[model samples]
Target: MNDEDHYCENCDMDLYGISPIYVDYMDLPYCSIDCLAERNTYKKYKTIEEANREAEKNRYRKEEK
Candidate 1:
């Protein structure tokens, strides 16, 4: 298997790969179904609806930070 095929050696997961591209917990990498599920909390939602909602929130939070 290739680097992409396996979990991110650095992160030890394989959730984000191929097609839409999986981005977990603030852009963390994953390797297997189990690994992906393990990061339910950190997983950055990939859906357009989710992104839009977070983007809107970020717009407001940016000023605070």
Candidate 2:
């Protein structure tokens, strides 16, 4: 795969060559992931614990049913 051959589904640029990233359901495509990771590494999402702390800050469940 060559970057010149395939564009990143995100930035529309030929990135990572033409290697199509595998995205699971609810996961991001190559473009979004690349952007989140600053374009030089894989994207990183918050851990469960980290998410809990962020969500627990002076906040009630917004729409949890």
Candidate 3:
């Protein structure tokens, strides 16, 4: 693997010897779901706080249903 492929694009976790690397829609790699979610949220909302707030609202709406 090249230098760029050796680490996750989101968390920079070493991908060497790690099986089943996670790839995003944009072809970005991640070590795990948490890292993927974090990067995706930030990419869409532009801030973690805003993404969290939206999640909370969605949770509340689900509870109400």
lDDT of each: 0.54, 0.48, 0.77
Q: What are the clashing pairs of model 3? A: none
lDDT of model number 1: 0.54
Per-candidate Cα RMSD to the true structure, in Å, reads 9.4, 8.8, 2.4
Steric overlap count per candidate: 9, 1, 0
Q: What is candidate 3's lDDT per residue for 11-65, written digit by digit as tens?
A: 7888888853556445566788888778778889978889889989999999999
How high is each candidate's TM-score?
0.28, 0.28, 0.67
The residue-by-residue lDDT of candidate 2 on 1-60, one tens digit each, is 443535554466654534456356633345445453443332332464555575576366
C-alpha-based local distance difference test score of model 2: 0.48
Among all candidates shown, the one with the greatest TM-score: 3
* Rank order (by lDDT, best first): 3, 1, 2
Weakest lDDT window of 10 consecutive positions for candidate 3: 19-28
TM-score of 2: 0.28
The ten-residue window of minimal lDDT in model 1 covers 13-22
